[model samples]
Target: MTAASTGDLLTTPDDLFWQEHSESITESDEELLRIVGSADLPALLAALAAATADTSFLSGDLRPPLTPVDTVGHPHGGMTPLQQERGRKVAFAALKRLRDEGITRARMLSEAETDTILEYLGNGHTEWAGMLRHELDLAPDKNGAPDWRFEDVAAGRDFTALIVGSGVAGLAAAHRFRQAGVPFAIIEATDRLGGTWQKNRYPGVRLDTPTFGYTYSFAQRTDWPQQFAEGHEIREYLETVAERSGVASLIEYGSALISAEWDGDAGAWSVTTETAAGTRQVRQFNAVITATGQLDIPNIPDFPGQASFTGTAVHSQEWDERTDWQGKRVAVIGTGASAYQIVPAICAGVERMVVFQRSAPWMLPAPAYHKPMTEVFSWLSRKVPHYAQWYRLWVTVLGIPGRFHTVRAEKDWPGAPLSVSPRNQQVRDELTRILGEQFSGHPELLKHAVPDYPPGAKRMLRDNGVWAKALTSKNVTLETSPIREITPTGIVTADGTHHEVDVIVYATGFRPSEYLEGIEIKGKEGIEIHDAWDGDARAYNGVTVPGFPNFFMVYGPNVGGVVAGSLHFMLERAGEYALKAIREVLERGIKAVDVRPEALDRFVEWVDTENRQMAWGQPYVRTWYQNSRGRVSQIWPFTNVEYWEATESLDPEDYDFLA
Candidate 1:
């Protein structure tokens, strides 16, 4: 079918993004061999079945064969050359059928049929299949705004919301609120739209998640230069979202949320914000959603004589573009995600680079981490109905099946502590194989690089072979020795070795437990939110908090699903739940809606118990996932689907409403 035959149901391939990445197209117009070669053949068949109302593929040779669960790809994705060619011709015929029938949208599958299809998609894994069924409705064209709106319940109520921090979550919050007809204002501390993407501009910085699934489902983009987009590209995408969604006009840049005082008398939050020019303003907001992300604050270790350093010192979050590393010795203080990206990016130019490691982070092998999207896939995404959704569904399935289960500690296991379960041991073995293969010649480096703890203990960094190559370079040294102090010239190890360097890049991660760090919030009982938590952050579904009426947070406490699941998807859920709660107050004409302390307690109890079963919560492994109390305060120790289900609706019984 020509592009016009499908009509506006599919976006025309004339977008600005399409034009920019046009050079990356490898396949000709008539060729779909590339598509079929890499296709999740079952999903392709399902898509065709839904589009053409043909289920014969399910009973025929194109049926999904049960295979061992693979976390990275479809279980039955692999096909022979002959099979792929035949699938390609079948797919070509299916496109023609779409034109012949003038089909716009594909029909949804029956629940029982969907279950069977889901099991097929997941290689007979039944447990996670139930969670993915709801998401089947959440495609680009289908799931945009909520069907319910504020106007439907509170027609004339002048309810306005204040969204603090114009970041990824904030942008999505603004988009959702706008779509629901809620008048809102987005306050940004910086002059720009993208929050972390704008701030963290270190070399080799890109999204660890796949670009297709990482994007907002409502405003989906078919054209991304790389499978995992770079920082600047992500920043540009956010800015584009603001402009295209018309939320740019509602943003007040250079304004930071300082404090929010809940006024019991006024029945609203008396919010305070400070601008860049030292001007502060206090305004009343019906609802205040703090979208200040988890990784905003830079955590620089207070090593001895850090001020005595003679060279340039900067945190990865506070990266200064003017500082040059070319031909100069550099010291990367911590081996985290930023360090993983920065070391390889700058090591080649540096005269000598020393990477100080508290511990080694597990790296997932991602060969296509640096590769761009192929033209054929892009064509399929645009021309084929529900292709992008199916692709995302497949990616989500691949991530879920064995992943969440393997991370949890199996009871009474008879294996090493290096892995949580037998399945986990298998995962650990594969990862170890990757590391051993990369560091084969360098035994000393391999020993230091290999993580003693199990995989998924800490967040895994996406590897493109650059980290291995950079570490093996003659100039790069992985220092496992304890750092004693910092002198006027450089850092000193406990072994009496003073390693001098020209620059000190602190890749020391963020204070994720310190939620809403700069913001001082006082709730109904005149209690500070920070003092309430006392450094251990906990929230109901990572959104609402007890005693804090009409307050919500995005990317908040214990929402850390570091193993699997997409962060953007979590952000969407959190936003939706928070909006739903806000709608309850405005619609019901209630003064406020505050989460019961018992609800928060139950959530914390569940999370803590589940965390005890996960790798991150182990006493042997310690990372930013825990706080000073040694509690897993950052990660929401549950399946991402569970969080999605919990936030699907706002329960009235969970909260107290003040009419």
Candidate 2:
């Protein structure tokens, strides 16, 4: 049940570390930092291996400190000219200490030493060391993957699990289970993995999170061309992970879970799956993990006379590549993330772009949003393993709540309805200033562009001035009017103006509030999962629920967060918790582990309280974070580390073990 520790993975073979990277650094970094290699860097790096043998090379004020709230993952810290030098200094120091007394081995960083390094990486957060050390797995050898794997002889055959959906969550579950040497099968309803990435094929579709932080902790790709990786690249990345990690072989492609019914006597669930070929198969599993994300279902509004509009109507999820966009007048509905990306992409090609805006999304200033990864940085990542992880840690600060202080609320603040706190107001002003600057040339469009809502009130879209440029174009019209109804030729606004368009692009987002929509889950006494909760979705630690023994869910209700980067971390945490719980069941020879109703209620109550203090929790704000019941079902009201700690252990008191 327990594995022995692997010692000091941070150390390297003394001379080889210096020999290989020194050559690479000299050759590659000339384009970016010329002051280094031709004169100072190569010499310093060549001598680094011998100099670092003292083990005291890690002691500092030795290198430059990291810039606070770094968006890009620079070597040591910020992207400023001075910070680059700081990064260079830090990189040199780490490489210097690769050997101790010319020996192949070195002492592991003391807790204090690790904490000092982690503090710099975590944007100076006091308590981030313990979490980041494990979560980020910054060390070269450590993957920080869940190790609560069952390796007993009966693990694969007798103790088995069923994972539905081959999305990132299912992939995480399958990968961890594979590591545990457990028998498992993933049933993906679709032919492909990557979930949203596979589905959304629209042009300009790319991840908002920086690729450094967006990638999986275990599988870090060093040579990404863009800071924000595009959709196809991400999909391919997931495909690679599935194949390379040996998870693809266990997947039943085109097989979708139809119903999972629990049997008390058998201590297993009778699961039914319908394949794309229209064949149905029944199987039994000790545990069922639903990795079908909440975002699986798309939300398309039913406007009056929508079907009669005659034009080609397409949701962002259902994008058609064959549709000729050349010289077409496209009407894009909903000014959210998809809309923001889509409008700029097709604006130049279209005769005219009519963007229908319901609410203006606050644009976060991201200058390098579309910037490509420089040759120097990409080369450095390939040469140095820790450099990539360090960079990941740097940009990863944006995705943690404490590091991103814009979401924290103050009680009875002066900002009130517009902004949550003084800090929140400050952020709003900065965002507003950026918006004003972007729209300075097109002052008329300013009225429709600037967000009236507080920062963190809804989803914040990334901007690099393209949105304003697209909107202000002669061929584009920014319409703030509420859509009245669809007509045979075009759309009619509430102002009674009929605008003609050749195509309709519904950029409306997914229905995240609706959890596990298609799948039928019948638990104890034939209680359906949906009917049991009525309209509300609640899960204990966003994993298990009462009466639904042996069932686990990723992307469960109230587990989503404002600062969840790529959502891979949260999924991993939730998946790890479920796997550990299953391990306990199989080890103890129990039927299944079900969360206690009291525990579920208590967790939900706490979540509800915390959500009330968040910007999305404000009664005035209407965001995708809320369900039909007006509850903030999407956001976990805590730091990423808090969720990690909570899910780190399987608390027996919180669950009921069925015999």
Candidate 3:
């Protein structure tokens, strides 16, 4: 499908909205076409109000509606039918005037007008107004113009910098560096880009979050083929972002970083690299950014006798598309997110499938998880300027801060092991109801599927009834027995039951707590970063370290899988902060800037303290969020908005400047 041009509304357009999975127009497309095609104010207001209703329970719209309408991919304020009618009239008149006058930019609206519109869209609340401004790049400049572009503030000074990995975070870093006129090189271990997206090639691989929230705020897309996009589409989007941001040329593909040694005297890092051709080279840079994200490394467990019995063993991260699973017996180890997605895609083809579950993950309801984006809605976004941005803001509001209340541990709440607070209990009940409904026919399977731990204790899986359907298949078996060992033929359970399979697929997640492992990073006084971490990795604000001077980690420890917001938003802010720190060094003539040890200690303490108050810190919960030492190090304890504010500006008091 091609992108729709500025003129064409009915004809199929290209670029962002094209879905490779389906070409047929949907009912949603027809509905959206009808809404945008006509110029009738009353009808438009009705359609607009109906389209933006609070179906997702997002936007904090608790008010009773006059009538419920399908509000897929739209934002609505919480209001009674009378209030909605009044609101529709006001919003319609304002929006119509803007459209007629060609006022597309945020600068066109006065501060009061902007606030009014933001408050209206935000469900009569001022909470998300600041976030909307920052996220949409509508923050005003000194001259009252909405300008989000960072100026080259390095005072004409130039320095060499090296970025490891060309993943989402690294690409973002490269973009920031290019914008700031910094000469930099991005070294990606693999031949291609998109890091995890490029590697995980299993069928039906897609994001849990909405596509609107997943995209880079700076580079928004109008055409997302689905509410939740597949892996290839996201990768393609990133590649497009790289090209458009002028960072495509700055990337050094196939060059993997081997080591980075800081020379205190020279005030530079001697970075070593190895190519696919066995060529090793050392390059010097003023600073090194380790954007080699947490999820890059696959955590492969050594199953006993696994080497002997393996017909074909593969980690989900290292999925080989060439492997034929047609009519083959498959043993899926670990029922995590990967397994949840992988099972439904391959269950129908496999002769017999066995899913070994250590713990049943809590599968949350996501109705539109499998639904595709309609062409008409895509066309509406493209035809109307600022429409896509507004939609994205709606997504951001829904995801970023909407669920923050659920994760926080309410000390006085009645629910304990099953849930933390009343709100969390409500969520658990909803999720349990959905799971139960999915497996209502199979009572035994449903029993094994329900998790014992409290909801939000681990990573939540998005369910569209596919996982339960796959498990209930006659050819599939969900094994809850503990595996004692792997035999030559198959897996040996503690009960001495043997389940034979042709292929062993490990759906085990990544070693997220082990931040920047394998790479030797030696700082001042030969202080190794790993040694400083001492099996418990900690970084100030999850980016900077005390011992590691002139080094910044993007998508680093405690920040990757944040529950509050999209990873893209976190990484973008992180990349921006890293660039700011880099600029500070060049502008101030500082050789190195190290986060003060005290500051680092305080940050770590704060993270620990905050973690104890969250679900991830529940003593009974065993998740990837915790390290071997049982410390929660992978997730950010605070909301995304808090992290954004903290990283928005730099504080010199927190760091020690060295000449």
Candidate 4:
């Protein structure tokens, strides 16, 4: 079905919109039932209750009726089991009433009624209602503008945007531009579209997050072949999404942006790019969005004598697809996220695989990893309205709030050294227990498996028992010792042991803190952005920099929510912000709009203060979030909602709009 007219959605109140969409909801119920696998009222009620209860990190700003009520129908926490049971029964009854009543609304719900429904579905979270609205596409476009109308109005603009990188972020930006009826072109460095997915072709490369949550919000996919899809599958999905969204044809493959310099006189950015044919081309755009994500440059550490090694050496990002991995003695260094997936995939085929770990990553059990969706389930999810949304929301919510609490440092809390707080320590204990159980037979491996740092300090590796099993394999060895050097045929440890191997795979991660690694971005007044930040990138709302006029970054500094939500969500939010800024420039007939330096500085300071309390900011733990100077260049250390609010509107005072 086509999307409802944007005019109708923008003018109508949210409550009214919901009330009017009953027929739409009714039409979806059959598919929804199919998705849920049963029409049993009790089963559906139970599922809804479970999902609502599963959501934590309540915003605490929900209206009165949406506030949590104890078992006795009083608003508060800490109710007894019987009281909780009563509350569940009450909620289930309400759900059954709504379900049976056919959801037809003659008029909009009152504030109280709206709050009640939010309470039932949103589980007392203030943010849930809005999220649901967004999922339903009932929410207005950026800054309360209607989608189609905005496009019509913006079609007259003479402005153009050049988006670097054709990954999810680039594609998201392109879609926004298309929706706004703006002229744009996407420049993808590689021959293919998928950025990281195209580059990293290592065996068993799969997503760490759930498929639904990882996919774009606007372009939701229900038939994702697998729960946690492989890289290639996701890449293909991205291509399909781009095509469906009408942004595919706009992308220019095998083109890389070398530098972007803002010309004060021309009021535009002069961007230099090199195509695959060894030809350099210069293009000018009114606005330029740097969608080159953090994972572009694979950071291969300079291991001593690494070049002298007489073996096939490759970074995991640059894995040679044609190389026969069979019978090869593989030496995989760096046991991070890439290594976690790589070891499991290559272990069975390789004669011997040595996994070198600098620090053990936090491993959590994920039964769904590597599990494919049943055909029926896939069909239901694709066809069902609100089915994929609910499921994805549930999966996405599970990772936040609870996890967010554990990461923040608690002052003087016990286990402060090992973990930031008691909740974090509990996470450590739980993960430790799992590690113990997994490596119970091998005490030596267990000792090395358990990380010394806090749970969220590094990325928590999703364990489907595959990672543990790979590590404990007969031919696999986990080495935590410091590497003294890489000899001709093997890796030499500090303990004087040489672990010989036929191939060396560097599963090292990317240079995330180093934004736009190779590209030189010269902002207004010949100020090089790379030199301005001085190796520590900072941005206002992670989208705009002070000197950069109409120059934006999609997955920029302080936008990496490593411990929280999906990157795709953050990218969309950032992309919308950038698009909004461009819209402002065009609508106002401005030459360029540079974010006020004072405003940018204040934002950076606030971010620094907030990050200081986060797990990544703790002095005891070290991760890629921080730069060489120990400043947090990556990771937004707050709730995703906060970032959403900050980016929703462009504050005119924060920018200098030139006419």
Please give the ranking of all candidate structures by TM-score, highest first, separated by commas: 1, 2, 3, 4
Q: What TM-score does each of the candidates earn?
A: 0.89, 0.88, 0.86, 0.84
lDDT tens readout by residue for model 4, 603-633? 9999999888977788877888889889988
Error of 3 at 567 (Å): 1.4
Off-target runs (Cα >4 Å) in candidate 1 are 1-30, 33-35, 53-56, 59-89, 95-144, 412-416
- The C-alpha stretches of model 4 lying farther than 4 A from their native spots are 1-117, 138-157, 374-384, 397-402
Off by over 4 Å in 3: 1-77, 87-112, 123-130, 137-158, 412-414
**Which candidate has the top score in lDDT?**
1
Colliding residue pairs in candidate 4: none
Count clashing residue pairs per candidate: 1, 0, 9, 0
Q: Choose 1 or 4, whichever is better by TM-score.
A: 1
Q: Candidate 3: worst 10 consecutive residues by lDDT? A: 1-10
- In candidate 4, position 638 carries an lDDT of 77
Candidate 2 lDDT, 538-603, residue by residue in tens: 999899989999999988998876644447778877887888888888777789898999999999
Cα miss at 163, model 2 (Å)?
A: 0.6
lDDT for residue 237 in candidate 1, whole number 0-100: 91
